[model samples]
Target: MMAGEKNPASCYLDERTFRLCCRLFLQHSETIQDGWSWEQIKGTDEGFMKKTVLIPVQSSVMHKQHGCFMQAENMDHLTDDIQSNVEDETAGVQAVCEIHAVLRYEYHVLYSCSYQIPVLYFRASTLDGNPLSLEEVWSNVHPNYRQRLQQGPWDTLTQQVMCVTS
Candidate 1:
């Protein structure tokens, strides 16, 4: 049986049988990893204004497969900076505030891809879940790349040659 599968009611009636079935399923599933859990970095008082809460989960696969560890402290620092700015007198409170921060872990076996690339993507918003602008988001990026990212042809690739084959 697969994780999240709906088993027959009769099979679940016996506690021992149900436990056995769960154990079997867990032992066979590729997605199941030990010690995976979520932790909240910020409280409601922080500028998060969204109804949806954010939680960060530590992922072993991300480290083992991608050769990269998702730094929880980096995300925490970003949230903390935003919170401090809000509390400061110079930066007045906005109509929307950050309410939650979450991290998600996903495991997949892609046969077509040769390398496992660990990509870190972040979304920031008002409590209502509306996304912040690039400027707002880049405020969290390292200063050296901030200016370059804003005005560079980062996404555009130069074509080295055009080829014609007979």
Candidate 2:
């Protein structure tokens, strides 16, 4: 691109422009080692976003996943020895927030030929690389996005990820 040339303003972004934008952003970030990387569609010039981020899971949430919780007094010693440090709940206990595990999010941004728009797609997994299903992903969506996803784009982002996959 020439110095006088401007960034593409249209919805359909060419691969060259996409590469340029990625380079610009990566250069700005100045991180030689980063989670964001480029991936080709194999035997084609088409490319898309791929980013992985680690998110901390609170002990409370992990606890809920492990089993049901009753009154603190009724709580047993529970030899499970989970991430929680709330040893004594007999007299109304307080617990510090602890990270049970770190979740890895694989994100993607691709131009959809069918929808004629850029679509977002992402999935979360454990550090061990166990991919979470779409149902698991939807179950954890924030309430705010629940309303927004009823419309297009967002609904397509998570569900219609066929933009690139298909």
Candidate 3:
């Protein structure tokens, strides 16, 4: 094996080994700054378990006027839209309210016997635990990941192995 890589296919994920894996992984993450808290969770699989990590939402931002996050180029279009809705007297400038929202993420990793690899299932939610829609989740993922997701299912086996937090 190489540094920072785990050979998942080389090791069988039985109940005992899965428990140990979760413990060791959790222990290692605890030493890192701002590490997301993880816990061992029981799975429906006869011989395997899962590791779940929960990241809580930290804050909510209120925008001065449409409470939205606008890219530099989009601001010009937004200004035009705002001006069109108002009288010519205020055509050049207008005030809008913007709101920026953040979400919490929950991830579960389990060994899939059918695929012979580990699968990571994650979801984004509000502070109260209401889940985000598929479209919203797709939008939230980094653009680089969008293509990987479109490739197919079970592709996450490799994707999970490649994911690293900076």
Candidate 4:
């Protein structure tokens, strides 16, 4: 394993710790319970076993709006040219939002991983206690990316275990 990678055993042990954290958050805050679980793709090849857990966040909503300066357009003659230009600008803004969201999510994961915690999770609320759907959490993503996730393999597992609590 790398110097900072978590061992597989730690992942199993930390499951309870993570669950407790989730329960605490659920009790006190609007914690979203969505995560990715996967075995290390190259564990045996490396010295120690490693595993990864990824938690989604709604915090991306803020990151999605940064540095978005809208240019003022003329009010006269709103022809096809003007409409096309406006659409192009909006598309660029959407692209920027998507990139910002993905980068922010990655940075958060890296920062959380630096703590040497076997289970890394993201907390986004203080009290609302509202559950977030995957579509809502990933709302900033591009249509194609969102569509792919909506139809991804995890969707099947989520549906199958919708009623099972953490």
CA RMSD of all predictions: 19.1, 11.2, 14.8, 17.5
Candidate 3 lDDT over 1-166, as tens digits, reads 7898978866656545655676677677666523434443467434322233322121222122213344455545654554354333233332332222334455666667676555577766643455565555565556788888867735542222234599
Best by TM-score: 2
On a 0 to 1 TM-score scale, where does candidate 4 land against the true structure?
0.21
The pairs that clash in candidate 2 are none
For model 4, residues 1-166, the per-residue Cα lDDT tens digits are 9998888765443434544554454444333422222223364421111222222223434333332222124112222232334323343434433322211221121112334454333332211223334444456456777777667746422311135578
Ranking by TM-score: 2, 3, 1, 4
Model 1 lDDT tens row, 1-166: 8998876643323434433444454455426433222222376321111112223222332233223343555656544544454324125323212222322212221111222221223344433344434543444445797677667634521112335699
Q: Candidate 4 overall Cα lDDT vs. reference?
A: 0.35
lDDT of 2 at 21: 77
Better of 2 and 3 by lDDT: 2
TM-score of 3: 0.46
Name the runs in model 3 displaced over 4 angstroms: 1-11, 38-99, 110-119, 153-166
> Which has the higher lDDT value, candidate number 2 or candidate number 4?
2
Q: Quote the lDDT for 17 in model 3.
A: 65
Ordered list by lDDT, greatest first:
2, 3, 1, 4
lDDT at 14 for candidate 4? 41
> TM-score for every candidate vs. truth?
0.24, 0.49, 0.46, 0.21
Candidate 2 matches the true fold with a TM-score of 0.49
Name the 10 consecutive residues with the lowest summed lDDT in model 4: 102-111
